[model samples]
Target: QAQIVELQKQLEEVTRARDGFQTELEQAQKSNTELTENNRGLTANIDKLSRAQHEMLQRARRADEALRVLEGEKEAADRAQGSANTKLATQEKQLKTFLEANEALESDLRKQMQRVALLERRKLEQEAEQSTIEAYYQARLDEMQAQYDRLLSEIDDSKRAAQQEVYRAFDDNAKIVPPSPGGGRSPPGKAR
Candidate 1:
């Protein structure tokens, strides 16, 4: 009986171990099902990512082509700008030359005008001096003519006085003469 009891105890222990193993197996199967569902969702996400990557690649190619066209336009514009700058520099030099010439001409004109003014002043002074000389000579000539007229008048007065004195002397001598013989008798060579 004691041996039989020992054998029964061993069988019960084995039975408990088997039950524990069966529960462990069921839990492992449930965990596997969840892992499988997770894997399917991951695969669907991978498919979406692949489509997005293809679209992005196509857009990148088109962007590169547009960048090349814009670069070519920029090069043409730079060439045009260089030519315009050269022309502007040449025009500025010509303008500077023209301004210098104009200034020189203005300076020369001012000098010529000053010379003309000086000559005109000299001419006016000379004309005034000539007029003064002419007036002085005319006054001297008038004074000389007045003195000559007075001298001629004095000579005429002296000649008339001498003639009158001689007539008076002849009358006085006749009054003082003695009676001729026989009151009207003829003197020698007298007609009777």
Candidate 2:
């Protein structure tokens, strides 16, 4: 009976140890399943972060191209402004020169007007002097023509008086002389 009891106790201890090992195996299997699920979640998060980084790089490249285009436009605008400034200065200088030339022409015109007035005054004075000389010569010609007409009248009167006196002497001699048979007058100083 004593040997049988000792064997029975030994058997009970072996059975307990077997149950403890089975519990430990079940707990280890559960921990391994949890670790696998966490690893899959971490991989999905890493893929998302990589896609976001690629999108950010593409946006930065587009911004750089836009900045270069804007800088080129600004340089062209500056060159156009410089050309406009140069043209404005040239036009201003030309306007000033034209104004100066116009002023000089006005002064020359005034001088010519003064010369024309002086010449006109001199011509009027010469015409007045010529009129006076013509009037003096016309008066002298009228006096000479009146003296010639008086001399011609006196010569005609003297010739008519001498012819009347000769006719009277012939008549007186004819009365003093008598008619002869020849029917002619006697001599000029004697009676018939």
Candidate 3:
């Protein structure tokens, strides 16, 4: 009975050792599984972070290009505004010149109008003088024509009186001679 008791105790101790080894092995296997799951989670998070970083870089590049484009547009707008201002200034100067020229032309027109009025007055005065001279000449011509007619009538009367006196002289000087040999004065009776 003593030998059997010693053998049973030894057998129990051996079984307990076996049970402890199995429990320790099971715990190690559970830890290994948990560690594998953690490693997988870590790998997935790293891949997500990498993808987010790449997207951020691409967004930054696009923002830089947009900024450059906006800067170019702003510069172009500034240049256009400058050109418009220059054109406006040029137009203003031209308008001023045109106004000055128009004023000068108006002044010249006024001077010409005054000159024309003066000339018209002078022409009227000259016409009046010419008419007066013509009237004086016409009166002189009428007087000369009357004197010429009187002289012609006086010359015709003198010619007729001279012709009558010549006839009377010729009748008184003529004498009648006798038919006999002796010449004697003819009597009022008939000659024998």
Top candidate, metric TM-score: 1
Model 1 spans > 4 angstroms off = 1-82, 162-192
- Tell me the whole-model lDDT of each prediction, alpha carbons only: 0.53, 0.51, 0.55
lDDT of 2 by residue, 94-169 (tens): 5455455545545554554555455455545545554554455445444444444443444455455656766877
TM-score of each: 0.41, 0.36, 0.35
* RMSD per model, one decimal: 72.6, 76.0, 74.4
- In TM-score terms, candidate 1 sits at 0.41
Point out where model 2 deviates above 4 Å.
1-83, 158-192
Best by lDDT: 3
Candidate 3, which ten residues in sequence have the lowest lDDT sum? 143-152
Worst 10 residues of 2 by lDDT: 143-152
Whole-model alpha-carbon lDDT for candidate 2: 0.51
Clash totals in order: 0, 0, 0
Better of 1 and 2 by TM-score: 1
* Residue 103 in candidate 1, Cα distance off native in Å: 1.7
